[model samples]
Each structure stands twice: as structure tokens, then as C-alpha cells.
Target: MKILTIDTGTTNTRITLWRDGKAVSVAATQVGVRDTAITGSRSKLDEAVRDTIAAALEKGRTTADDVDLVLASGMITSNVGLHEIPHVLAPAGIADLARGMESELLPHIFSKPIWFVPGVRNDVENIGLHNCEEMDMMRGEEVEVMGLIERLSLRGPAMLIMPGSHSKFVCIDENNQITGCVTTLSGELLHIITHNTILADSLDRDFATEINPEMLLAGAELAKRIGLGRACFNVRTLDQFTIYQRNDRANFLLGAVLGADLLTLKNSNAIRMRPGIDVIIAGKPILKQALALLVQNDDYFSGDVTVVPDDLQPQLAGLGAIAVARARKLVTP
Candidate 1:
């Protein structure tokens, strides 16, 4: 099947063209929901989405009619994005996601089925750090989780650590269902602290910024030894003391943020209570960070850690999984 999968995230929007369950072409734009909102309105965001999709398809030497299915996930289904689809509660499987899938006809775009995959919601009380019943909803990650399950041929339970604006620790059951999840604001906080806060002056947020392994290890060690709140000031102090360059400081800050997030999860009821669940890191550069920390903190993470590159684009796998489930009559279309 020819599938077009779109992911509208907070900082970037990506579109991928896949054939027979493999991604053939992919494209991305900075026209994310938050970025678009700063310059224009919802209509403009929709236009950007449409244009990006067209651009991706054009790159693949195909047009809308050539596509058999269009599957969209991520913030695109959020209230702030293109359309709002109610979330499917967690402990949901491929069939559940397929059953909850909503469709729309874009006569201008294609004659194929366009599905908006619903996000997953964890509404169980007191499941997270707060010790109070807090609801956590994830839109795009659910699809990725499904894709990971099928791609890896995983059975029994698995732990997925997806790092992004809001890193997620998700649990997948033997039946390929999202059992539960925890969201950490580590990425957002890292952005705010490094770019918008006082630490910005000491740290460089540039593409050329290189990772300093030594500083990275040091920062992570500090986070583990002294806690994040106390260790955070060291980013500024080291810079102020001329102990590291601006670029090196950026790496250190990143390490600290990731280390803190890892420590929190290590001690959280979600991870500490569940032992021996294999871990898979999904996404890019952040996967490297998580891998380093996970390997170093062996006592906290006893299971294997596998890093899956972003090139696979789990959203596409997830869409195909749901589509297959629907075809097999495992779910109501």
C-alpha cells in the first residue's frame, strides 16, 4: 500500500511517503503548530500542512491519487492543530486505535481514505510523579509505539522512551497495547532554561554545537549525585568560571536535563515498580543522550536499550498497523 503519513509536532512538522510498509521519501518543515501560531493563524497552519504534504509526494514522483491512504498523527489532532479528535484511552491496542480512527474526505487532495489516528489517554489516578490523579495524553507517540511493536515483533511487555519536547516513558503490553505512560517536561524545560532563561547567555544554541563527552558525563554524574535543582546552577557557574566554552556548556546542559529526567524516571513508581521490561529509545540525537545515561545507570535500568533512528518514522508503521487490523476485521472500520 502507498501511504502518506504526516506528523505535526510542536517544533517541526514532518511528512513521509511509504510503500509496502517502508518509508521511500520524507520531508520536514519548521512550520510546526507553535511556530506557525507565532506568525499566522490556524488557516495558515492548515495551508502549511497541505503544502508540505504536496512537496513530500512530489519528491516521491507521485501525486495525491497515487496514494492509497493518508494517515495523520501528532499535534495535528490536538485542539491547537488542524482537527480535534477525541483520545482513545490507554491499554489500547492496534485494533482499538483502528476502531477509534476518524476519517475525512479532502476532495482537493486525494480520493483515498485519510485517517486521523486518535491519541492515547492515561486517566488512571496517581500514576505519575505528583502522587495525584493527573491525566496524560499523547497523540503522535501512540502511533509510533504501535509501529515499534510491530516492527520489532515485540511480545510481552516493553518500555519505550521517546524523547522530544515532552519525553515519554510508555509501557506496551503483550497484546501490543499501551498499558500506561509517563510524560516528563525535560525537553521543554531544557529549551526554556537554555534559550529563554539566564543560562542562555552562557550556553550556545547553534547547529554547530558539538557534544563534549567528558562534560556530558560530568553533568550527568552531577545530576545523579546532587539532584537537578542543585546541579542546574553549575551550568552557569562553570561558564562563569571559564571552565568550559559556550558550546561545551550546551552539551553539559543537555546532559544535565537528560540525566535529571532519567533519575526521575528511575525513582518513579512507574519504572521502579516494574522490573525487567526491555527499553527502546525512539527518535534522534536525544536517543544518544538517553543511551549514554541508561548505560551508565545500570543499576536503575536492568533491561536492554535499543535505539531506533528517526528515519523509520514510527507514525507510518503505526498507520499501516491500524490499517492492517482494520482489513483483518480486528477492528470496526
Candidate 2:
């Protein structure tokens, strides 16, 4: 089976062609739903998806008609995407997502109605000021969780940490269902603070490429004891009082925010975490390393922490899409 998977985030879109199980070729573009949100039009998003799919098909040496299945996930199912699909309630598994899948055709992209995988949300029935913080949602990470579980043969109850623009902490039940998720915008917040804040000059307007264990541990520990805001201010003090390089200072800042996120996961009501459960952190090297190091150094969930490398990130969503498609039996060999 030839499967094409499309993942559209807030600022980028990726399309991959998969034959059976392995990825064949991919086409990505810088444009995504952000353009739609900025201009209040979907024209750019539509063109980008169309062109990207064509490029992927061409690069894979296959025509659009030869493809048997096309699946989409991520913000592409949000209101700003090509089409909006409702979210499935949490406690969802591969079968739940497969059953929740919605099929729709956008003649501009493909001849077949692409199967849209529904995102997941916490089961908070009514929104109120008293219990507002207990609600969270995810666009594309659930599918990745399912794929990672099968890919790594993980047993639950496990906590999956996916770091990106919006980092997601997903908790899977013992039955391998996604029970709930906690979302944070620390990645985007770090970007905004680095370029737009007073600490820009002190820490330098850049992110850490390498792991500085001391600075990272220091920031995380400080954040644990004090608040995140005050811990961030310490970055400036580190640059002035200490002889650390700008890169190390940036790592300190990285640690502060991610450390705060770790604290959130531990103390969050959005998802209930059990002690000694398995924790998996997956993302770029910088995030993966920082989180793994924090888990080692700190009094984190007392669970076994698994760190996924950066090399396998490119095909995660594709593996997920293919796996869920087969589960639904939407298209069979």
C-alpha cells in the first residue's frame, strides 16, 4: 500500500509518501495555517498543501492516482486548516482514532477523500472559572504516541513528552489508551523572550545547541525551589557574575522553561500521573537531552525515562498515519 501522510502545524506543513511501512520521500514547506490566520484567508494554505503533495508524489516516483490512501493530522484539522474535524474525547486508543476518522475530499489536493484523523481532548464537559485549568487538547501528538508505542513496544501507564512549539505531555493508561494530555507553549515563549526581552543582550539571542549539564541543572533546581520568573532572572545574573559563555546562558534559560514544564507535569490536574510510571521524552537533541538530564538529576516522577533521538522524528507521523489507517481498515490490500 502506498500511503501519503500530511502533517500541518501552526507554521509548517510536511507531506510524506510511504510504501507499505517505510518512508519513501517527503516534501515540506514553510507555509502553514499561520498564513491563513495572518491574512484571514486559506489561499496560501491551500496552495502550499497542493504544491507539497505534488512534489512528494513526484519525488516518490508515483502519481496521485497510484496512491491508495492519503491521511492528514495536526492543526490541519483545526478551524484554520483545509477542513475542521471534531476532537475525540480522551481515553482514546488506535481503534478510537480510527473510528473517529473523518473523510473529506479537497479537489485541489487529491482525487480521493483524505482520511482526517481526529485530535483528542480531555473529558471536561463544562467550562467554568473554577475548573478551567483542567482542560487540554492535542492536534497530532496522539497518533505519534500510538506509533511510538508500537515502534518501541512500550507498556503503560506511560508518560510521553513531545517537545515542539507547543510541548505535549500525554499520559497513557494501562490499557494503552491516551487518558489525557497537558500542553504548554514554552517553546514559543522562549523564542519570544530571547528576542523580545531585556535578557536578549545578557544571554544572547540564541538557543543552546549543546547540553551544558551544570547550567541546565542549576536552572532547573532553582526553578524547582523558586518560581520560574525569578529563575529566569537568574540567567542575567549568571552572565554577569559567572564567566559562562552566551551559549551556556541560553541553555540555562532553556532549562528554566522546560523545568517549569516538568513541574507542571508533576503537579497538574489535567492529567493524573502515577509514581514510577514510564516516561518517554522525544524531540530535537537539545530538548531531549535537557529533559533526560533533568530526569536524572531531579526528583522527577520516579519513573524510568526513555529518550527518543532526533533522527527518527521525520517519519513519526507517517508511521502513525499508516498504523491508524490499517486499524480502521479504511483501505485494505
Candidate 3:
């Protein structure tokens, strides 16, 4: 089957052309929902989404009519996206997402109808600012989680740590369903600490090319002990008093930021975390490495931890898009 998968995020748009369940060509652009949010117009996003799909097809030497299916996920299904589709409730899997998938004919974007996968929400009702910490939702990560399950052939319950601008920790059941999720803004906070805080110059306003495990854990332990407020100031002190290099300091800062994220994992009721659930950290190598180390050090979990191979990482969403299509019976097994 020839498939066109589009993934839209806050700062980027990506399209992948797949044939027989393998990505043959891929295209991406910096255009994203940020443009729409900034300008209060979807023209730029619409144009990018439309053009990126066309560009991917062209790169694959095919056209829309030749495609068997087109799938769109992420913020594209939000109100500010191409078409808004309400979120699917949690405890969802490929089958649930398949049932909730909305098909629409948008002539401006594609020749055939595009299947939009709704994101998953923990709970969206009856909130009074109390017991609200358990609520979480995800857009594009649902598809990626499906892809991870499909690719890894996961049968037992597991937790997925996808670190990004907004990190997501997705919980899955033995039945291959997404039971719950926990989100953290560690990435966004890391950005602010590095670029917009007093510690910027201490680390030279850049991320570490190569991080130090020792420094990283030192920061993590410090955050776990004194909390982030003082831990952040520790970055300045480490630079001013200690002889750690720029990369080392950067690792310390990153560790401190992600350490707080680990706290969210321990505190989140939405995650439904249990003992012996395997952990898969999918993202940049440095991040997964750091996160894996932290998870190993903490007493919260006692299961095997694995990092998604870099080569297979990019194909996760596309693999997931195919999984949804298969679940919807849009294609043969």
C-alpha cells in the first residue's frame, strides 16, 4: 500500500511517504502551528501542510491518486489546524483510535479523504482546580505510541518516555492500549534556563554536544535533594566556584531540569505506573541516556529499560499511522 502520513507539531510539519509499510521518502518544514498562533491565521500552516504533502509525493515519484491512504495526526486535528477533530478518551489502542478516526474530504489538501486520528485525553470534565494533576492529553504522541507498540511488538504493560519540547510519558497496558499519560514541560523550562535566565552565559547559551554522566547525576541528585529553585542556582555556583567546563555545566543544568521531570513521573496518578513495567525512552540519545540513568538510579521502577534505536525512531509515527489504518481495516494485514 502507498500511504501518505502527515504529522504537525508546534514548530514543525512532517510528511512521510510509505510503501508496503516502509518509509520511502520524507519531507519536513519549519512551518507549524506556531505560525497560526502568532499570526492568528491558518494560511501559512495550511500552505505548508499542503505543499509538504505534495513535495513528499513528488520525492516518492507518485501523486495523490496513486496513494492508497492519507493520515493526519497531531495539532492538525486541533481547532487551529486543518480540521478540528475532538480527542478520543484514554485507555485507547489502535482499535479505539481506529474507531474514533474521522474521515473528511478536503479537496485543497488531497485528492482522497484524509483520516484524522484524534488525540487521547485522560479526563476533560468536572474540574475544580482540585485533583486535576492527573489530567493529561496528547496529540501526535498517540500515533507514535501506537507505532512503538507495533514495532516493538509489546504485549506486557510498559511506559514510554518521549522527551521533547513537551515531554510525554505514556502508559500502556498488556492489551496494547494506552491507559494513561503524564506530561512535563521540562524541555520548555530547560530552554528558558539556558537561553533566558542568568545561567545562560555560564553554559555559553548552548546545549551540550557531549554530556558528562557524573555531572548529570550530580545535578539530578541535587534537584532531588534541595529542589529545582536552589538546584538552578547551583548551576551558577558550579560555574563560578567549580572548574567544570561548559558542556559539563550544561549537562548539570539538563540533569536538574529532567530531574524535576522524574518527580512528575513519581507523583503523577495519571501514569498508573506499576512495578516491573519495562521503560522505553525514545528521543535524542543524550536525553534518553540521561533519563535512563535517572530511572535506574531512582527507586520508583524496577524493570528493564531500553532506548529506541535512532534509525527506527523517525519511522515511529509512520509505523503508527499504518497501524491505525490496519486497525480501521483500511488495508489488509
Candidate 4:
């Protein structure tokens, strides 16, 4: 049977078609509506969603009716997308996520069968005894992670990090069940610093060419001194140097921002998973460099780091896996 999966993220929307236990076709588009004003003004996002699915279907030589199952994860079920479903708290298994989706978000999408993966949540206290709830949610990419795991028939505790607007570190135990996870604001911070903050104009749009060790070190040191609020301005202030030196400065600035995110994740008790674990860094190509930089700088351990090719869209893999599991009744409804 063929399955269609949709992953709507903060910056993009992706669709994938799977058949006979393999991905047959895929399509992606930048459909994320991070700005409240833009999301309110237009159904452009909805149109993009339709277009992405259409492209996938065309490439896969299939239609919506041909799909036996449909699965979705990400912001698509939030107040912003086709529906608004609140997150189901964690210590949750695949069954819980499947059931939650079946009951809450599926009825509107398709009557045949549909699944929505719920985000994981945990409330923990540490350091100052502050009560904080860390929610690890996936809208579209949940299907991708599940699909990848299913394809590999992986049976062990594995850590998967989906880095983007909201970076998530998801943990799956040996039974192929999601145990617990953490979310970081790395992507949002990058967007805010580069676009909204005064630093936007100071840095080049192409960040890939501007990264280096010296810049990373300087950025990390500056962040430690002034914090994120003041660091945003330093990007512009440090731009007085020659063009050759500007790249290093930009790299440092970016590194510091990413470092802050890693520090937050490291300190939070919400992410209590063991160290020296296998990590799958999923997302765009630039993320590979970012992950490498993080490790090189000792932001996170470097051992056993596997960078999954961005070729297979995570949402598609996830939705296709859900569809297959649902078809066999392997996943509880």
C-alpha cells in the first residue's frame, strides 16, 4: 500500500510518498510561517502544503486516493496549521502517540486512516529547584525518524537530533519506542539574531563560508561575557575590520549563539540521557558543519556522531513508517 506523510516545520513543509516499504518519491518547500503577521495575512502556507503534496504525488505517480494511510507531525497540528491539538505529555510510548493522534487529529484529515505523533513532555526541577517542563514535539519529522529506524530495523537506545528552527534531541529505546527528549531554541535564536536583530545587516547571508576556529572561539568567549542580549549587537560592532577578517567575526558570533544553546541543553535535567550515546544529526547540509563545529569546540561529545543524508525527508520516512505500522496493527490505535 502507498502512504503519504506530511511534515510541517517552522521554516518549511515537506511531503513524502512511500510504497512497498521504501520511499518512492519526495518533495519539499519553504512553507513555514514563523511570523504571526504573515501567517495571519495569508493561506500561502496552506497553498504551499498542497503544492508540496502535489509535487510528491506527481513524482511518485500516485494520488491522494491511492494513499492507504496518511501521517503527519510538527506544527501542522498546532494552532497555526490545519488543526490545533495540545501536546500529550511523555513517559509516552508509540502506542500512546498513535492513540492520541487517532483520537485527536486524524478524523479531519482522512477517514481511511491517519496518525499524528505527539510531542514528549516532562516537568523536572534542578539547580535552583525551578519547576520547568521540557516538551520534545515533532509535527512532520516524527515520521522521518521512525521510518529511518524501521528501515534499519534498529534495536537499541539511539539519540536523534533534528536541528532546525526548533532543534530536538529525541531518544528511542531498544524497543523502537520514544522514551524522552529535549528541545533547544537554536534555530529561532539564529533567525532572530541574523534577521530581526541589528546584527542582521552586519553579517552576510551566506554563513557557510564565514565559519572558522578563531571566530568560534571569540564568539563563545564574548557570549560568556555579555550574554545573548548584548552579543547580538557585537556582530555589527565587530564589522569594522577588513572583509577577510569579517568572516571570522561572523563565525565567532554564530558559534557563540549555537554554544549558548548547547549549554542550555547540557545544564537542563530534562535531557538526562546518558553520554557517549549514538547521535543522528538530521536536517540540511549546513547542519553537518554546525554539528561538527559543536563537537570540535567541545560543545558536545564528538564520538559516534552519524550525519544522516538529507536525501530522505524525515517527515516522509516517519509518515510512511506510521502507515506501515498502522496497516499491520503493530501500532495501537
Candidate 5:
């Protein structure tokens, strides 16, 4: 089966074509659900998606008729996207995710069927006492996690960490089921603190260049020593003391924020106790910082840490797998 998957996120949209369990073609654009929904008209969003799909089909050398199935995940199913599909509760497996998918015909774009996969939700009960039973929801990362499990042939419990504007830590069991998940606003918070606050003036450096690993590790260690509250202020203090260069300051800031995130995860009772934990860090093009922190803070987790660069294959595999499961009548709606 030829499957096309569209993964729309907060700032970008990606389309990947899959055949026989591999990605044949992939395309990406800056038009995300949030980027196109300025007017609140569903028609406008649909039109944008149609245009992207048209472009992708041309680039992939495949017409609409050539595709057997079209699957969409990420914020595309949000209230601001094409439509809002309610989230499927956690402990979800392929069958649960497949059953939650909603199909619709876009005659304006193609005759082929399009399915929107619903997001996954985990209630507060599974997260432990500090949360007091609040709910967490994710749209795009679940599909990637599912695909990674199958591609990596991971048959045991594993922790999948997807870092982005908002990060997700998903836990899967031996049965290849999502047992629970946690979301952190660390990325967003970092942006706000560095770009929107007065602290921005203290650090002016190009982030595209290679980050200093030493400064990054030092920042992580500093956060661990004094906690984030004081560590955040330490960035400014370093500026006053002229202790670090401009680029070094930026690296320190990155380390401090990532360190705080690691500290929170390390302190979590659920994370500390998970058996035979295998860590997979996906997404985020620059992974040196995250990997360093993970390796440095080995006290919280004792397992192999694998880094998988963010690509189009995992999303394609995930969408295709769910579609196959549905086609075989393995999932109930």
C-alpha cells in the first residue's frame, strides 16, 4: 500500500510518502496549523493543506490517484486545524489509535480517503501525587513513538523523549502500549525567558553555530547544584561578572534550561523506578546538549541512550501501520 502522511506542527508541516515500509518521498513547509488559522475558517485551512498536498504529490512523482491512503497527524486535528478530533485516552495501542481515526473524503483535493488520527490523553491518576490528577494531551508525537517502536524492534519497556517547542516523555510497556506520558513546557519557557524577558540582552549569540559542550555541561551541573530558580538568575550574574563570553552565555542558558528539565524527570518517582529503561531521544536537530545531560545525569536512569535524528520515516511508518491495522479489521470504531 502507498500511504502519505501529513504531520503538521506548531510552526511547520511535513508530508511523507511511504511504500513497502519505507519513506519514498518527503516534503516540508512553514505552513503549520497555527500558521494558517488566522481567520478561523475551516475552508481556508483545508485550502492550505490541499495546496501543500498538491505540491508534495508533484515532488514525489505521484498523483492523488496513486496514493492508496492519506493519513494526517499533529496539530492538524486541533481546533485550529482542519477539524478537531477528540483525544483517545492513554494506555493506547495501535488498535486504540486506529479506531480513533476519522476518515473524510476531500473531493476538492483527491478521490483517495484521508484519515485524521486523534491525539492521545493521559489522565492525572497515572502521573503521580504532585499533579493531582490533571490531564495531558499530545497530537503528533504519539504517531512517531509508535513508529519508532516498530522500526527499532523495541519489544520491552522504553522511554521515548521528543524535544521541541513542547517536549513529550512517553512510556511504553512490553506489549507495545502507551502506559503513560508527561509533557514539559521547558522549550516554550526557554524561548519566553531568553527572547521575551530582560535576560535576552545579557546573551546575544548565534545559536546556529556549534554549542560549546563544556559550557553546556557546566550549566547543567549548575542547575543541579542550585536548582532552576537560582540557576536562572545565575545566567545574568555571569554577565555582570564577565565570567563567560557572549556565545558562552548562550550555551550556558541552553544548558540551564535543559538541565532543569532533566532535574524534574530525575526526581519523578515513576521515572526513577521504571525497570530496564531504554531511552530514545528523538527530534531536535542539535542533540549534543540533550545527550550530554542524559549521560551526565546517569543516576536517575541506568540504560542505553540512543539518539535518533528527526526524519520523515517514523511518521510515515506510524501512519501506514495504523491504516493497515484498520484495513485488516483489527480495530473497532
Candidate 6:
């Protein structure tokens, strides 16, 4: 069976085509939609979505009619997306997300049957820490995380951290059920402080910023002591004197923010690991480094840690996972 999956995120739109459960082609495009705060960008968003899907289809030498199933997740269903499908609360799984898609209101541009996966939400005490209400509505990465977990056959009490603009830590039980999770705005926060805020001018554009270990460690320590807001101020001050010139400074700042996030998880007692337990880190390389630092922290180290580079075509992983769910009748066609 041929399946096409789309993952429309804030920064980009990605599509992947799968043949008999293996990815054959994939494509991505920068999002043209601006002002995601309103519905006016819907036209542009729809265009971007179609363009990405069309490109993927072309690369795979297939047409929409050739696709046996279509699946999608991400902001595509938010008010800012092509549709405004509401979120289904947790511990709702893929089944609930698929069911929600059946009733989802979509724009006329989509002629194929598309399944929109809904994010999980809860109002628990930790909700305030990560804005659970907001994080409650994840899109494409949820399936990717679940797929990676299943692919690894990870068993019993696993913690999966997916880092990006909005990082998330998802806890799974032995049955691959999501029991609890937390989200952090570390990526977006870093972007804002370094680019849009006062620190932009001082940042060395050419510096291999991600690998600067000194900056990572400093960032971690600063965040541990002064907190995120104050940490930003410190970066700005150091930038003035070229203190940030030391490659280590940037690494510290990065580490500080990530460490703070890990600290929150630690406080919540969310880092549980038994014998043969696994920690799956999924995301871009820089964020992966931050996660690696966390895993190496003496306070948190227990089980084996495995970092999975996001697959060449993450949308395929997501789509394949959904396909598995559908084949098992966990979700309706």
C-alpha cells in the first residue's frame, strides 16, 4: 500500500511518500504563511501544504489516486493551519486522534482522505510548568516519537525527549502508552534571546555555536542559579565585553536552559529508570547534544541512554506508525 504523510510545522512543511511501509521519497519547503495568529494565512498555508505534497508525489512518481492512505499531523489542524481541528485530551492515543480526524473540519483544497492526529492534554499540577494546555496539542512529532520507541522495542518506563522549538518529554509505560509528559519553550526562548533580543548583535554568526561545550555548561549553571529571564540578561551583558567570545560561554548558556528544563523533570520525579531501561533522545543535533549532557549528569544517570537521530524522512516514520495503527484497527480508515 502507498501512503503519503504531511507534517506542517511552524517553520516548515514536510511530506513523505511510503510504498509498502518504506519511504521512497520526501520533500520539504519553507512555510510561506505568516501571522499564524489569524486565519488570513490559511490560503498561503494551504498552498504550501499542497506544494509540499505535490513535490513528494512527483519525486515518488505517484499521484494522489495512487496513494492508498493519507495521514497528517501538526499545526495543519490548528486555527493557524488549513483546518481548526480541536485537540483530544490524554491518555487518548492514536485511535482517538484518528477518530477526531473523521469529524475534523477541513478546507476544500484537500480532496484525499487525510487523518489528522490530535495531541494529548491534561490539567495536572505540572501543567503550569510546561503550559500543558498549549503543549497538549502536539502534531507530527508525536507519531515520530512513538514510532521510534516501537522501532527500538523499548520496554518498561521509558522517557523520550524530543527537542525543537518547543521541546517535550514524554513518559511511556511498558505497553507503549503515554502516561505523562512535559513541554518546555527552550528552543523558542533561545531564538528570541539571541536573535530578536539584545544579544543578537553580539552573537558570532560563524561560531560553531552548537558544539561549543563551554557555552553549554555555562548556560546550564547560569540557569540553575538565576533562572531563564535573568540568564538572558547575563548573556547580553557578557556579549558587551566580548566575554561570550570564549566558545565555552555559548555552550554554558545552551546547557543552562536545557539543564533547567531537566531540573523541572527531575523535580517531578519523571526520570524513572530500572534495569535495562532506555532514554530516547530524538531531535536535531544541537538539541541532541543538550540531551546528551542531561543523560550524562550524575544525578540522572541510571539506565542506558540511546539517542536516535531523526530519520532521513521523519514524516515517513510518523506515517508508517499511523499506518501500523490503522492496520491493527486501532484507528478507522
The lDDT per prediction is: 0.71, 0.88, 0.88, 0.64, 0.71, 0.65
What tens digits encode model 1's per-residue C-alpha lDDT throughout 201-251?
Answer: 777643115567777777778888988876777888987888568767777
The reply for model 5, stretches above 4 Å from the true place, is 35-38, 124-134, 211-213, 267-276, 309-333
lDDT of 6 at 58: 94
lDDT per residue (tens digit) for residues 1-120 in model 3: 899999999899999999987899999999988889899999999789889999999999998889998998998888888888888888888888999889999887777999998899
Models, CA RMSD each: 3.8, 1.4, 1.2, 4.4, 3.8, 4.0
Residues 1-333 of candidate 4: C-alpha lDDT, one tens digit per residue: 687777776677777787855678989997765532364843676577667877998999887778776666777767676555666555555565566674333333344455555554553335243545453455544555666675556555777777777777777776766666777788777877766666666766435364576777667667767886677567776786546365665686677777676666556566665666666667777666676567556645644767776665444445444644574474444
What's the lDDT of the predicted structure labeled candidate 1? 0.71
Residue 40 in candidate 5 has what lDDT? 56
In candidate 2, what are the lDDT values of residues 1-333, reduced to their tens digit? 888999998999999998877799999999988999999999999999999999999999999889888999988999999889889999899899999899998998788889999899999977898877899999889889877887888778899999888999999988899999999998998898788888889866888879999988888888888988898988888888988899889888888898998888888899987768888989988889898898777664688888986666667877787788889996573
**What tens-digit string does per-residue lDDT give for candidate 5 at 81-167?**
776798888788777887888887778755766788888887445455676434567887777777776666767577777777787
Pairs of residues at least 3 apart in sequence or in different chains that clash in candidate 1: 126-133
Model 1 bad stretches (over 4 Å):
35-41, 108-113, 125-134, 206-214, 224-226, 242-248, 267-273, 309-333
- TM-score of model 1 (CA atoms): 0.82
**Candidate 2: C-alpha lDDT:** 0.88
Query: Which portions of model 4 miss their true places by more than 4 Å?
Result: 27-55, 83-86, 103-113, 123-129, 133-136, 151-156, 174-176, 230-232, 241-244, 299-303, 310-333
lDDT of 1 at 326: 55
Model 6 C-alpha lDDT per residue in residues 87-126, reported as the tens digit of each score: 6665645455556664332445456767666655543445
**Worst 10-residue stretch by lDDT in candidate 3?**
123-132
